[model samples]
Target: MLYLKSIGTPLVLVMALFALGGCEQAEKSAQQMLNQAAESAKQAIDKTNEAAQQALSEATGSEKTDKEDSKDADGQKI
Candidate 1:
């Protein structure tokens, strides 16, 4: 009985240490995944904004030309 008690404490402590180490590694992995997802979302948003701006510029440019073409040389409407 004395031999069993002496070995049991060390065994339990070693098991606890391993469990804590695994938990720490899991936390780090989760954090890394979250950071990657956030970066990807930010990049997607940036690309969407850029495309929207380009489309808006093109639309406005065509409208300006149409307005100019409808005017006479004296700046009066045709």
Candidate 2:
């Protein structure tokens, strides 16, 4: 009984420290994962917007006019 009593206090302290450390590490890892997912989603949205704009300009025949306006007959800016 005496030996058990002497060992119990240190055992409990060690277990509590492990629990707290594990919780802190898990939270940091989860936050990093969330940040990466948000960045990927933002990139996807930008690409989708660019594709939609290109499609619209092509459909309306504005793509050719845009090319023409970029230069004069001598291949210089107008």
RMSD of each predicted structure: 16.3, 17.1
Error of 2 at 77 (Å): 30
TM-scores for all candidates? 0.69, 0.49
lDDT of 1 at 57: 100
The sequence of per-residue lDDT tens digits that candidate 1 reaches over residues 1-78 is 334234354455445555677677656665565566567668889999999999999999999999999999999999
Check candidate 1 and list the clashing pairs. Answer: none
Residue range 1-78, candidate 2, lDDT tens digits: 334234354455445555677677655665555566567668889999999999997877886778778998898977
> Counting only residues 3 or more apart in sequence or on different chains, how many pairs clash (N, Cα, C under 3 Å) in candidate 1?
0
Residue pair clashes in candidate 2: none
TM-score of 2: 0.49
When summed lDDT is taken over every stretch of 10 residues in candidate 1, the lowest stretch is 1-10
**Clashes per prediction?**
0, 0
